[model samples]
Target chain A: MTVEAREARQPWILLTPAVSAVLLLLFVPLAFIAVYSFWLRTATGADQVGFYLDNWREALGDAFYRDILLNTLKIAAITTVFCALMGYPAAYFIARSRGNKAILLLLLMLPFWISYIIRTMSWINILGVSGAVNSALMALGVITEPIQMLYNEATVILGLIHFLLPFMVLNVYVSLEGIDETLEDAACSLGATRWQTFLEVTLPLSLPGLAAGGLLCFVLAAGTYITPLVLGGPTDAMFANLVFEAIITQLNWPLGSALSLMLLAVLGALVLLYNRYLGMAQLMKGLG
Target chain B: MGWNLVRVWTLLVYVFMFAPVAVVLLLSFNASQFGSFPMTGFSFRWFVELAENEAILRAFRTSIVLGLLTALISTTLGVLASLALVRYRVPGANMISTILIAPILVPEVVLAVGLLLFLNFLGIPKSFPLLLAGHVIFTLPFVVLVVQARLVGIRRDVEEAALSLGASPVQTFFEITLPLLMPAVLAGGLFAFTISFDDITGTLFWKPGGVETVPTQIFAMLRNSISPEINALGTVMIVMTVGLPLLGAAIARRMAAGRGA
Candidate 1:
């Protein structure tokens, strides 16, 4: 075969396995879930062959599901704000530093590689009744009791923030790293105060990164299961946790699938917003 | 502007970030049976205790095997797919790329349920290979994206020169292209391995009876409370995960600077 022919064939040959896997595992299954969401769970444990909007109707209309949705958004928004607040200064410091930036960046990113479950559990060891935080407080006589720490909304948020902060820092860092240092210098030379220049130039340009990071933090926090499962109170459940309960404990696959589809719908809408406003390149860059 | 102010702020951030993980690590080494604070005398008992825990050991073996297999398969597929996307102007390239990356964007719970339903419908047994397949699907996009970034930096003329010199395509790729892509391939492999190693949702859904990975095992144990053995494991993982990647990123950064200079 000619070289061009061989080269042309190679790409398809290499792409076959991945294309098939993704189609089968990711796309096909999601399509099935979309279909399942329309079906009804029967008196027995199986999904019934009926087309209805009950799942969607319940998800939108029921107060329980509505509360879960609102809680998901609340936790995600809080996590995003905290992450950005903490992450920006850290990313800025690392970006501005000379020799220490790489080290600082590494430290921020290290927790990402460890298991999310482990990291969430680490908080348990630190914040549980007999855990470290209360121990320290008691040692210092700061509180009379081992304050309730784990299995609370505060602890759930703490775990989500801990897990997500690296992502926020890294996204902002990537954007900051890409900005030309000369622009900041030029702003300074043009009689702009450091704060004024930052407000006018740096913040707007970095807004894409901020939005991307916030979206990511929100998606992850909203969709998370292990954190809430491990550290959250019974009432602190997110929508994803409800999906888990429906599947595993309740044995209601159709309802679980319906709830998951609702989560996906909201997630898809938000992702669309990010892609439109923030740009896909920026979103992907932030993810990396 | 004050140096001390900067120092205090940075110190607080560092402490906030590292303190919990650090506490877990410290408590793991304590001689006390309970995984708690107020240091008892140091001992290696948990490490030994971890070794003796058959469930933990079984899960560890499963995780390592899964991670290694997933890394190799995903990295190979990723390298090839990345080469395709980068070198060829195929139709539907954008769509192909988007679909490939869609897994990363999809919620894990959704994917897990979808995969379970699909596998059940297909009558495929949820076995080790099935779990491996799940992991590969999850990790492949990451490998492709990272490897593609590195591949874009490679000059095509180098490959063209080899082709013009009567080198076979395979020869050119092996001698020139593959070697140049090594850093990225390794990086992608590391990424895949880490994701596979840490995965819980997909594994939990797909894993067969009597086969549990580390995260799944820890998750079951965590229903009671966080164990000291997990803390020791986490400490070891923290060192390797952070240490190795940082070393690689630093090396890459230095190389880029050196070239620029």
Candidate 2:
């Protein structure tokens, strides 16, 4: 081949392995699920080879699945709010600091280096009925009975916040870090109070991070299975947990795929909405 | 200034971040069988017990292999993808990058189950290579992102200069580009390794029975109560994940400083 043709062909050649893998493994499998969502499963846990919309029909019509969807969205929304509320101040503090910013950022990321399952289970030892918190509370005469704090929405939220808070903090920190400190200083010199300057200058710029972090938290919370498996009770199962139950326990692949699609659709909608409002570039900046 | 509010908030936030890990590490040393309640005297008994556990040891070995292999595969693909994106003006480059990275966006559970079903339909048994392929799918984005950041500064003139001196394309890549790109390549590989090693959701769904990675073993162990062996495992993993990366970052930073100076 000529040099120009060789150069032209090189990019495609280099990309062949990765592109094929995505097409085969990620994209095609997801497409398989999309097709399987409309098919029926057999008694032997295999999908029948005919197209039908029964799975989607049942998923859309069933109050049980509807409740799971709503509960998943609700839990995700609540978790996002809690993470943002807790993460914003910490991120702001780190961003506002002059030196040791890298150190603080590293500290925030330390927890994420460990296993997700281990971190979720750690709450059991700390929050169980006979665990440290209840035992300490009982000793202090906070209540006669140890509070039922282990398996509920409260515990689930706490676990999610613990897991997701670092992401939020990191994203918000990136956004705040990108803001020109001189602008805030200028606002202050123009007679704006510290609060006023923060309100008018800093927070608006940090909105991109807030939106990105909030989206990350929402997606994670909505799809979390393990945390809820370990920390939540029967009543608090999210849609992912339902998907897990349907596939692993009930052997309902068709229903499971349908639920998976629903979760994916919901998350995709939120992401699109976020991009429309906050700009995809800002969210993309926080990901690496 | 009333920024003491911010100061106290910072302290509380740090406490919240460290508390779970500190508690786990403490309990890992507890002498009592019940993970709950009063601690008996601290001992190294659990750490010792972890050494005798064959399953955990095997899982650790498997994990190291998996991590290394996944890192290799993903970094190769990622470096190639990065080169394609940076060096060539291709149609749909942005769209292609987005699609390649979309694996990170999709929930791990969805990817896992879908892959499981897809493999089953294809009649491919879950094996080591399959597991590696799955891990590569999840981690390729990290490698690309890390390398892409570093690739931008590498001027096109350097390659052209090498070529003008009669070097072949491959020679130009190795003798010129690869050496310069080494730091970023290593960083990307490290990210891929760490991600594959710590993977839980995708690993759990797609793993063949009787073949347990560290996380899967830990999952099984947690069904009872948190054991000292598991604690030892977590502690070791934490050290590897954070300590090694920091060490590498320090070395890279030193190299950069020396070059600049």
Standalone chain B TM-score for every prediction: 0.89, 0.93
lDDT against the true structure, per candidate, is 0.83, 0.84
The residue pairs in collision within model 1 are none
Clashing pairs in 2: none
* Docking class of predicted structure 1: medium
Q: Specify the poorest-scoring 10-residue window by lDDT in model 2 chain A.
A: A275-284
Candidate 2 lDDT by residue in tens digits, A61-139 = 9999998889888888888998998899999989887769888888888887777777787787788877778888988
Report the Cα lDDT for residue A110, model 1. Answer: 73
TM-score of each: 0.93, 0.95
Residue B28 of model 2: what lDDT? 75
Candidate 1 lDDT score relative to the true structure: 0.83
Residue B175 alpha-carbon offset, candidate 2, angstroms:
1.4
Q: Evaluate model 1 with DockQ and give the value.
A: 0.62
lDDT (10s digit) by residue, model 1, range A1-288:
996898678889978888888998899989988888788878875578678888778877899998988889899999999999888777777777776776787677777876787788888888888888798899899997998867988899999998898888888888888888899899999999888888888888887788888888999888888888888988888888888888767767778888988899899899988777756788777665
- Candidate achieving the largest TM-score: 2
